[model samples]
Target: MTSAAVNRRQAMGAGLGALAAALAGCSGESGPVRRLRLATGPEGGPYNAFGQALAQAVAASGRRIEIVPVSTAASVNNLRKLDDGSVELALAMADAAGDAVLGRESFPRPAAVTALARVYVNYTHLLVPAAGPVRSVKDLAGRPVAAGAAGSGVQVVAERVLRAAGLSDTSATAPAPPPASAPATERAPDPSADERPLGLAASVSALREGSVDALFWSGGVPTPALSELAGEMPLRFLPLDDYVGALRERYAPVYTAVTLPAGVYGLTEPVGTIGVGNYLLARADVPQGVVRELLQVVFERWRDLLREVTAGARLEPRFAISTGEVPLHPGAVSYYRSVYG
Candidate 1:
């Protein structure tokens, strides 16, 4: 063929190839896959176990979900991460969610997070070595205690209880006398010595070593570590019944009268305490479809989930909407109302 004919044929072939490529792009069958990220609490914690169960359910939905383990300061940090988009989902204390949304306590600004469900109730647990003298909140006034790690929901509640009990870090060890030359105005007001702040692990160690008098934990009933500790060491569960009225008056409405049943960990009697629910939270900006699917998976596979953790058995459909102050996510609301209503 002539040169001109050959050039014309090459140009036509190139145009056909470009047309094919465009058609392939518009096929729509080869779409990108979506992934859901769930942020769980520190290793071996209830939040972590719950998160793993949730991730499993989501994965079983024929969708992709990844459970990410996070060493958090508990509810506060979890809410912050969810708001900032660092995590799409997280577990938080219902009270903490309320506080964060209202910008109360440690929250400097309101967090843009929404609740999916109230998963389970967390009990305020005060554990002392079985052989120790610490028997109640009043008994701990001048004693060393573990108030939970900083940034944890446990720490916040523990501190609130201490303040309610008229105790402080310095309440147990203040010097007996002020300087002779100091002005009267400079005199300390009830200078009680400060108690050292111990983290969760450190508190456990302290108890084992007999260095600390007691440890305070705010978590779901039958916490694994607490159960394990009870088996290994003689431990006592302090009752919060005496201060229930005061605790309710001072804090959010999360605190409720409850009992730790006898034989939960071979206890001789049920421990009376105030309780709060644990909530599943998500960023306000998460795609509505994703949240809806996540909640759907949780409810649809409820039985399987119940087997994953002890707390799972408590996630009833009616209780899913049990959150008080934190507004339920619209997506979750749709799912809950469909099932419960």
Candidate 2:
């Protein structure tokens, strides 16, 4: 058969599986349709955008599962919802996921969650005014900075980056005073950055209004809100790749060096920055059959889904299985075995 014929055959098989699942769901208790809540990020953010698209795609694919995208504060909040059994699927930064699994950082205890796939890479973006006094990460000391929203993966990484840059007090969630043993000269500058917990849009507004000296954001290249802000004002991106080694050494080894290519947001040269993987996660108890069917839609219809996500994201099955440290859901392992074998 031709390639097109094979494609049609595969699509038909998937549709049949969905139909069977739907019929099975119907046979039991004339119950409501099987809906799974997906915890996404703040409105207009990458997580929410992609989650909405994925939910729509699943609906269009005639799957028995209805993915409802729930707007949230992003990674950390999403993970808590999963811990409490409020959501089945969530999008999270790899660093946050690793921390949750190991009971590190914000998580007081290890969380029971499993990965479905490593969906994409989020570039750490540190936006500053072009003519501002803050030229580098170290220059952020004693300045007002709009860190990411409280309980967001962006905040999680932002705090680490600040600590690596020796601005320990810039952390909004957990701020600690400089050690008393340290000499005055060796301590951080007199006053530390005033860290505010602001979401993407609010951060952009704060930056534009001169209320904050810099803002930290983690998202796909050319995050829509930031892009719009760039058009309205002259902006400079501070490099974060310099601290990747420190972040990896102190925290989990989830940070990688990545570049935002030139011409994006009117840049004249590529900017090296820190990168973190984003994962599609589920609670440990999600049904195996449900996960299997969901993975079918995610993999087979990934091209359509990609158009809805960040530009540089990779959704291929080969890359999807690289959820380091966080164990893969049994259904995800089964799906990959079927594809690879």
Candidate 3:
């Protein structure tokens, strides 16, 4: 079959899966459910872990819907998938989502994405081995680093952090063979593949093997993988607190200063860093009812999710409007209004 025919079949298959899952969740309730596809991050990343937990909670919300979380590179890549109709919902960084809607940066043209909720703040981390000499972002100038996988929001954050610090990635990278990501979903290629840096896991491994100086991570804190790695070995965070203004100027106004409390990773003092909100995004044309239901998953099943994932529990209706320049989905607005008013 041709690519077009294949895509049509995929859509039909996705629709069928969505229907089946929704019906399974309903048990004996008589309600019509719309299935949605959620574009999450790489397999082990916070987005993926938290997204999976959130998906389960939604499936059990006693609502008329089902969500399929597809592992992706996050943010920009998710937005691109939204444009192509490959996914109906996506976990995107506020900055990348804003840039896509404006047809700037990674996006080639204007995108019609809207926000379901400003979920949580993604705290950018520049982690280096405690014994390693590199202690700041500026010290990474001539060192090997893992900027994040291709097309990942982690890469987007890494690039901006580097540019603000007046450093450039001159590390030479060899092509990495693609591995199966989350069953059968083909991960979109990273745009900055030519200027290679290792991905998160690879960077952590490299740090242990003494190949790379540091790795950049932008996700909710108490990230399980990083926590486990830090527990195994001492790690230090290079502060990005000073460059918040430069990052905001270069990206969007959504950037803010945040402090990673000391001891979350066993450090003695708090670490300062820049943060960006990660939004639950959807195409502007997705049904308002679906968006409202997605938001409902966040509000209704929040406590259960909190037990499942710390980041997943951080969803608050008050902070739901924090997604910087990205406009809210009408369905979300309706849901929020019903609650707050």
How far in Å is the alpha carbon of 112 misplaced in model 3?
1.0
What's model 3's lDDT at 57?
88
Q: What TM-score would every model get versus the actual structure?
A: 0.82, 0.86, 0.80
Global lDDT of each candidate: 0.75, 0.88, 0.78
Model 1 lDDT tens row, 1-341: 99999999999999999999888886654444456566666666767777777767776677544445565667878888887888877888877888889988779889888888887777888888878777778787657778877667787677767776767553233345578898999977542313455556677788888777888877765777777788898888888867777767866577788888888766999999877788888877776766777777777776665554454355677788878888998888888767677
Q: Rank the candidates by lDDT, best first.
A: 2, 3, 1
User: How much is the lDDT of residue 149 in candidate 1?
Assistant: 73
lDDT tens digits, residues 54-161, model 3? 889887787777888899877788999998889988888888888888898799898888888876788888888989788777677656778888888888888787
The digit string of per-residue lDDT tens for model 2 on 1-341 reads 89999999999999999999999887764545678999999888889988988898899888678999999999999998998899999999999999889988789999999999998899999989998888998888778899999999999888788877767564444356689998888775544567889989999999999999999999988888888999999999998888999888877678999999999999999999999999999997888878988999888877777665678566887789989889999988988888786
Ranking by TM-score: 2, 1, 3
Q: Which prediction has more favorable TM-score, 1 or 3?
A: 1
Error of 3 at 94 (Å): 1.2
Decide which is better by TM-score, 2 or 3.
2
Give the top-scoring candidate (TM-score): 2
* Model 1 ranges with Cα > 4 A deviation: 1-31, 64-67, 169-199, 303-312
